[model samples]
Target: MKYTSLFTVLLVLMTACGWSQNDKQNTKMNKLTDFEEYVILNKGTERPNTGLYNNHFEGGTYVCRKCEAPLYNSEDKFESHCGWPSFDDEINGAVKRKTDADGRRTEILCANCDAHLGHVFIGERLTAKNTRHCVNSVSMKFVPSLNGKEQKVVLAGGDFKGLQFFLAQIPGIVRTKAGFVGTGSEKPTYESVQSGEGNYVMAVEILYAPEKIAFDDVIRIFMEVHDPTTPNQQGTDMGSQYRSVIYYNTEAQKETAQEVIQELEAKDVKVTTTLEELPSFVEAAENYQDYYFRSAEGPKNHSYTKRF
Candidate 1:
């Protein structure tokens, strides 16, 4: 009996020690770059529009850089145009909100590792969820979806800056890029196109998930957001490049555009929005991209061109 009791105690101790070692290894922190450490440990905020995930919208899981803890799902991310990665929701139990002395902002952190993310804002009305998790891209690493296949649509609705502002509010849109398209030149640039050298229309290319939103819905939203009736004129910017047009990539998209235009004309709205095959899409100069999203001072609810 003495020997049996001794053996049982030894077994328990061995198992307990083994479990502790395993736990320590499991919680090992990943090596972070200097920028990451600055944001995650020091609680520093990355510059607006500078974070990799700010304009990034891929099907993936965002995990903490420190401990690889799952923090957010890509589907919850939206284009707040606030120059940071905005997520309406986080993985349950993955994120915890904490209040600091300056209670004006709610700080979000990785619940598992307690790594500092960015601030959380409520009542933004930017998304139906009404919550925004403005996070620094360096604080989290993305694990892309295995079966994800992103799709896109391009539409020119006068100033892409104004168009992007409205479209970014939509729930399922993954990302929006301001660019020039429909130009015949080999290389189209913002300066050249804006100068009417290429006659390229300033357009916004939208990337979206098919499962979350339908293509027809994108077309409808495009029509509703901008004055499709005005030819080559969105707000005050008027030129051949500003003319409203849709660059379709497939027959289905073309047909969908036709249907939307027909529906608009049925309501006595003379539509001048033209349809053309997808052409060379050159993203505008870096400074011109995300014109409104790169800052928080612009029109929040509507396009800046609303007055004109």
Candidate 2:
């Protein structure tokens, strides 16, 4: 009888330990199954918590946790009280929408991947269009860098022909005879600047100029070669890095730009070119030093013409 009682006690202790281990595991899984980690791991779906996240006033960019793709910018985000982070518009082309399984609702997916994030609804008075994207917080991670002070600069280079072609691709740059001051030549000009080490000289500014190119012609070429329509901005290049301004050496150059504007208006084309009288032209950084000749293989299929 004593032996039987000892055996029973041992069996009961073993069962209790096993149950405890199982309970611990269940608790771990419950904690790890949050929405953000779930999207990062399983790429699963998350429902919008309309009450908790609907009126979120936080300012941050929402990024995909799985692939770290930037999904929404803070400026476009709004409070909809719809139970998720709401945005009137997505960053240019970050999020894509599709028909959901229920056939009555539209599903939202990450632009980088077709990961099902949540649903988008229309006819809500929360935003301009009454459209709200109810997203699950678990599918996203907040990134402060989106609204931080880190500005992006893009440096691009190509031949004179390539530059002309790139400008043509932009909607604003156009050819006009009214802005033409004199006969312009198509001969190329080369400018050389000393390197930082001063050991080797770098050739920059491979530009096309006419034999008797006037000051107005130079201004016209600068405007046509780059986007002057955007104030202190350029295509794919932002901030002051891509600004369009004339580097002038004399008062005559400034007068020529002003005259060209008058002539452009006379020809019925609105002129928005910026002219600045510069003391001297300084050599850009080595990386930004000579872009055109260095990147000859990049975007060279375009053609350049001297006439409007």
Candidate 3:
């Protein structure tokens, strides 16, 4: 009878140990879901400050750590000063807000299971839309393959459309039309006519009609090619000789140009791109026309190659 009692106690102790191990494993598995899984299990690195600088991502919603409940979408994720994942808003019925344990602030939790996630703050001015939900990176997971992995930098000539077929073979370039409308002619005019003065004259003119290209595309291409980070110049050409300028027609074009300049400035570029709202432009003389083609074969045998 004593032997039987000893066996029973031994069996109970062994079962308890097994159960404890299983419980610990289950807890770990629960934590290793989504982006958090990548960070923890796969040893992935999370970008500092919730990876806000990595804005190329486009799809999927982030979910909770304790339970796989959906929380915030990619669109809602924006830059916040707090060094964690931040959401401008959360999906409806997905999260519950309650006072935190410290009793000093409100905290957010998984709505379905009441798992503690992070804190949500109101009335922050990071974006035009006001509100921020600061979340710990360990508390959430990003869905698989929804984020953008391909990174590309595009550079376009101002007159890409009229020369589309010619430009297509150049890698990383997509030919799109851009126009200088109203009274201005789509050609370069020789001004402050310094004959042997400036460094290489990069006289660029947009040849396509206005209907073909959007204003935004032009701004994007211009920003891509030249270092807007530099003020008032490009490459070796110094002074106003290689000055970047946008010649606009209507008031709308003017406004768009200003907005583009402002956006570039926000990206920390020291931009000195000149804006010329002009009445008209006169074409350059015929002798200087098609200069690039002629120069490609002769004494000025310098070929212009496209960089993707």
Candidate 4:
């Protein structure tokens, strides 16, 4: 006798949880049970604070139960405390939003199979993006990303404090690490870099999964969060250290960055962001690790507060 993996067993159990008795051969997706059908096939809402994924924090991809299309990543899930799983963002083109029956709330559905997931709300300000996709746990399944891709990109579009805040909130992104690059030195401290002792630029290392969130998505967010059109300036902060730059770690990333830049240029958006190969990333001082989250006066009073 052979034993199956825990993940395999979990998938079987989740599928069984939604397996229907009849009409299973007619549809492209797995037939949903009565409760799953209520929430996924028909527009229905689960009881608040009763969702399985609301408090579940694990590394995996949340896929639509109907068609199994990848919808949201675990990294995107946040503790909205709204009784359901809340995500600040979704995989590009994975979710579709429409006006609810009451014409007030925006209903969310799977783009691939049109399965009812839940609803999305804006202006919530629960996260940096100010958007939330409230979803029902029964409508989806969690597939662990056993070998998720991990890539690093260097971002510098003025105040890194703001960039760190936004990127940290984004789904598919790993721990937002603050550091320095492109200084032509082995390591540069915050004081040395700030005082022009090493000609280094203020930057942060964005670790992300390209599969879960497209590189273009990251670039788009980066462009929106800061004034890339400004040369070496972000609001009142003006210096070469604040220059908009993206240091790519791989040739593929470099190509993607160039392609995205050209697309923006075609639209007449003058992007002053530079594309450079990744350099030695020197970790910033302990004080600046997570300035936005650790701000004594709160993040609202910060210089980049207005951007978010």
- Best-matching candidate per lDDT: 1
Give the alpha carbon lDDT tens digit for every residue of 1-308 in model 3: 00110000000000011111232234222423345445433334454432321221334567654455688787887756566667878899888899876798778876765556577888778876687887655555454231232221222222212122222212222122222222322243333322223232233343322332356545554555454444434444344434456666557877877887787778776766767665443334422322221121211211232211
Best by TM-score: 1
Candidate 2 regions with alpha-carbon error over 4 angstroms? 1-55, 145-308
Q: Estimate candidate 3's alpha-carbon lDDT, on a 0 to 1 scale.
A: 0.44
Cα error, residue 113 of model 4, in Å, equals 49
* Per-candidate clash tally: 2, 7, 3, 1
- lDDT tens digits, residues 1-308, model 4? 01111110111012322333323233346655566677787787777754445565658788887777789987888888788888999999999989999989999999877889999999989999899999987687767554646777888776666667556555566456677876564477766666556677888787767675688767776766677788977777777887889988888888887887888788788889999887677777645654543332223312221211
Pairs that collide in candidate 3 are 34-141, 35-141, 35-142
* Candidate 2 residue lDDT tens string, 1-308: 00110000000000011111232123111122233345434544444341222333334566654344678776777766555667777766778888876789998887664555677888877777687877765555444422232211111222223343333222111111000011113211222111112111111121211222344554454444444455534444333333345544457656866776676567565544555543222223322221221222334323333222
Candidate 1 or 3, higher TM-score? 1
RMSD of each: 16.8, 26.0, 24.8, 17.3
Q: Order of candidates by lDDT, top first? A: 1, 4, 3, 2
Task: Name the regions of candidate 3 deviating beyond 4 angstroms.
Answer: 1-58, 144-308
Ranking by TM-score: 1, 4, 2, 3
Q: Is candidate 3 or candidate 4 better by lDDT?
A: 4
**What does the lDDT read for residue 295 in candidate 4?**
30
What TM-score would you give candidate 3 relative to the actual structure? 0.33
- Please give the TM-score that candidate 1 achieves against the real structure: 0.57
